[model samples]
Target: MKLFKNTFLSATLTGLLLAASWPTYGFPLLIFIAFIPLLMAEQNIRVSGTQKKLRVWANAYWAFLIWNLITTWWLINADLFGMLFANLVNTLLMSLLFLLYHSIAKRVNQILSLIFLITLWICFEKLHLIWDFSWPWLNLGNVFSDYPQWVQWYEFTGTFGGTLWIWIANAFGFYALVQNLSRKTAQFILIISIPLVLSLWMYTTYHSTGKTKEVIVLQPNVDPYKEKYAIPNLEVARGLLQQTDSLITPNTEYILAPETVLAQNLPFGNFEYSEVRSLLRDYIYLHPKAQFLWGIDSYDLVYDSKEVTPSSNFVRDNLWVNNYNAALFINRNPAYQKYLKSKLVVGIENLPYKPILEPLIGNLMIDLGGTISTKTTQKERSVFTGDDGTKVAPVICYESVYGEYVTGYVKNNAQFLAIITNDAWWSDTQGHKQHLSLAQLRAIETRRDIARSANTGISAFINQKGDIISRTQYNEKTALRGLVHLNDVKTFYVRFGDYIAYAALPVMIVLFLFGITRRKKSPSYYWPR
Candidate 1:
């Protein structure tokens, strides 16, 4: 009973430490030692002569579920079932990952065990970025988001470097704690502080490299539940025009509106009746240099059988339609341009393993975007270019959460970044704030200024250094105009995306193979109880 009590308390302590290290309500320093208690508990389970494997997994699950619940409880404001599934499934996966590492510890030496643990975790995070059921909101590196001064090196290693740093610190810190205030305590302090000192020096001396450009971001403040879709697209366009009346200027090179601002589907290859275009074109003629960009629900009708793919919805025996959650770019030269949103939300935008999951689950997918239908996506990230050859990455709502995914745009010569989102679906919660924090990390990684526009809040201008230079409040109707720089120099992260995750993959595979083939009979080192 006493051992059980200690293990339970340790598990919950690890959870609280992790939750307390998150942004908006917590500090990043806690993350350095957050996993120590759990490590101790795992060590205890191995040494306490308890041979039950499920016991090890159960405690890990408890710890992970607690962390998931505390950090993302605000997801309930958006979708209860989605939130529940996210927590339940993610907890199981995380526990299994920890269990695998624990198994490897029994077969291999301590040093190899630690190495495998870090490599396996890094590989898991990398998989989360690409897989269909991706949800990387709690990646450990993100803990330093609110305090960018501590992670200025993200330009070189991206968020994976931060993840690596946290694990190394926790490993040494755990060792130091177990030694009872021994000489290694000083080593732990240096492990925690050395990277921070370097980051601070970079923050203080770094100069932004780019040409200054002005932009205007609009926040319509429309209620997503009742009125977002009920209104006509013409009315939405006119409302946008009215809001930007005073703010629109000749110096404004780009004008950004929130994602899905055009609730109705616009017919592709034809814009004769595009109300947003009509109003914007009339106004844009006055300031021909300004480009109007917005997120739209768009569709392309096809009778030609060759143009259709599996994503196309069958309208009749011979007709099909391709639906897109897309970005619409309007200017005099191109008149109208569209970029399909590629990275889709798991259940909302596209079903994970649709051919497999659909038959098994039978339509459990939910649409919190106010628009229905599983959205079809483009294969590649498309860069929207102006007449003067200014390139911008039109990042839609959920795509902003991905780190390496955003680098694809910069590689394609995107001079600046633009994020259009409708965060009102989650209402007033940490969901939107956490999202904005992720965007800041992207700004730092790419060294490109960001023009972020959102429906019902958080329209802002982020500099090349990840600072929110100017921003609007949540649940407010306003237009934000600010100057942003266009950078041609790409950061090391932008040049080679997530190299840490890449390097970790091969090491993980090799370690796993060795652990299975060369199992040791005796314990490497018994944990002192």
Candidate 2:
């Protein structure tokens, strides 16, 4: 009877907590307090009868399964069959992790056990980031996305550290509210104060202001399926050129187009350099004042006949190699510079985990038509210089989530950010919105203005404070031309990268060790089934 009651309470609280994250049935306070009942249930089971360990582990697994399936049901949109199968696999993995957690918790002291759990959770989140079936989408750290102000410290520790903060707070808060007050109240108060102090520190540090620039973002509602198959390349190019004519105004300095806007690759370097040069010259001649930035598939061929040693040869250097996903910077003065995107999206763009999955999944199908696919492996940060020498760093679709990578660009002196994406793939689903929200953090991290252009979606200009000064509505083909701020003011996040979260790893290790050593301290606390 008691087992049923505890399981019921655990299931209910876990469900409620998970549901609080979904838009359909969400309550913010429920998100914070919901863990209390569930945590307490587990804590009570810790000191129960003989069979307590297995019972607690089983409930933990069940609760995690509930949390994941309830909150991340949207992953089903990936593929009906694959998503269901993936969820089952994920649930089982989570169950095993929880079982490990139960064993470790039993071995450690209370405080140490909490630390171990926190560390293990962080490690799991990190592992999910780069693993074979990597999906860092609904990481617990993202639950605090709505609470951006409290997460201002993410610039220093990254958002994974923010998850650690919340987990620690929950542990302390649970102790303060449920456990007896035996001078542990001070510890609880201190634990809760961490986020508060960091937020206050950030609030004070964000006072310095910077200059803003006028930029234009193009949200072209181009369906990849239709663009590639139904419509002719000429028709698409004509439409894009016509759209450019309609959108460009006197105030528009930087005009951004969505990814793959130029269906065909543009010639770069000295091969047909004259022709390549002529096309851009004509473009600049037509729009004599506007500085144009467009996403184009670019081709490169070296024609420099300068003699060099074998190793120093341009051919050997692969400088004359193939094309790249590139950004064209055409200034009104007839000057042009192209930048290739570096950080490619893992599965879609470049699969570093391709070898492992190739034998298993046997090539997943892209919904859009393509018999074979090419993997992009570009890793050099390409910076484009504006007419005034303002260096702009560009990240393509799905690359915005890599805040650490974006930080690397800022460190290398990329002033403004231009992210070209095609959200049309997801239609008007939460996928696009979530992707856009994640991009917002890039601005906060670097304190630079972001000019984002998306296909069939939310195009916006993000400011230094992570605020969107102007934004276009989703699912509309419209031009958003506004001044985007470009400031060199580097935030603390750039100085010290993901330090807070990484520091928790060692702390977690210590906690796990403590848990194992303290098993004898509570030998009489096991429960009978």
Candidate 3:
């Protein structure tokens, strides 16, 4: 009874430490300590010989479930029903992952067990990134973004490497706590500490070779509820243009405004209509010298009927809804390019699993800006060339989260990254911070300077080494003008993606096989709940 009480308290304490170390407080070292108590709980389950392996897993999972629920409750604001489902599903997934670790630890030696846990944890992280209903937001590596210096090594291996580093630290710390081999455990800790200490050394000393450029980012602080939809289209356009004009100067080679700043009632590409054409012409004339990149909605006409509706077999459905979440690149020389956002946010931007849920949800099309519903057509990566022939990869808002997607441009020789976003909807929550934090990884991944322009919040310049050189205030109606760096040099992560995660898988398989071959010789022990 005393052991049970001690174990439960230890597990819960570990869970709390893990949650507290996330993006909220930015203390990633807390994660290295967080799992020590939980590992002790596992050791108690085995060394004390009180509970069956399965029962121990169930109890550990319950503690982790509680931790997940308490920490991620903010997801409810995104969509109440969606949040509930995500919490239940993700908790179950995490529990199964923990089960694999516990089962493997049953047969392996201490060194092998530690390696197994690290491999298992990273495999699960990779699974979440690729799964159709992926939620890569809460990755343990993301916790390190608060100490930007520690994650500078991301240029080599991406955030997954950071995940490995943290887990290895925790494993050593746990080994020190659970066993009584003072000298042996000290040796183990020293071995593990080598990598951790080296990462810190590398973090402080890393540098990048990249050229910088001067750019201006404007955030009007337009209220999502009031200013976005309250007034007439012409009134909103005038306000945005006036604000943009004030921020522009001779040195500002490029200017950026938030997503959907121009509130045209009609669809974006109804340009045959004089009103729409006039708006584009006026915008073009306003910023004559500087190249301006901003988000807008557009519907392009398709001449080839088959090309129009690629998904439909019948040409009768040829008038396909060519809706897009798009960005327009306008230069002083009357050159313009349009790039549609490829990766859409699951719930808010695109309906989650529309084909499966549409029958139950009753035409789940919630219109925001124009008459046409939010739809997807062709998805493309965009790079815009300025009047001075400076080329940039334009990352539209959510696309910044996808490291591989941004790196694809690096492989093609993109000079800089320009991300335009409307973060007003998320405000000061972890949502905004998480979004800003992840952008750092992309810069490190691609080895390219990032000019991030956000609405109602953090606009900043990120260097090739993933350092934020300059930034703007949250909720301020202001412009951040700075010299943004540019670089075409590619990092190892960009050249070879997910190498660490993939390499871990074979090691995990070996551990699994070793556990299977070394199954306990005695009859299975059982304990009642």
lDDT per residue (tens digit) for residues 298-334 in model 2: 5555455453222121345535334356667777554
Where does the lowest 10-residue lDDT sum fall in candidate 2? 307-316
lDDT of 1 by residue, 207-265 (tens): 77777777899999999878888888889988987888779777888889999898876
Alpha-carbon shift of residue 301 in model 2 (angstroms): 12
Model 2, residue 86: distance off in Å is 5.5
RMSD of 1: 2.0
Q: Which residue pairs in candidate 3 collide? A: 212-485, 213-484
TM-score of 3: 0.85
Error of 2 at 338 (Å): 4.7
Q: Is candidate 1 or candidate 3 better by TM-score?
A: 1
Q: How does candidate 1 fare on TM-score?
A: 0.96
Better-scoring candidate (TM-score), 1 or 2: 1
Candidate achieving the largest lDDT: 1
lDDT of 3: 0.69
Clashing residue pairs in candidate 1 (N, C-alpha, C atoms within 3 angstroms): none
How well is each residue in 89-198 modelled by candidate 3, as lDDT tens digits?
78778767777777666676766877888898888888877655677676777777666666666777788877887787788766654454456666655645665576
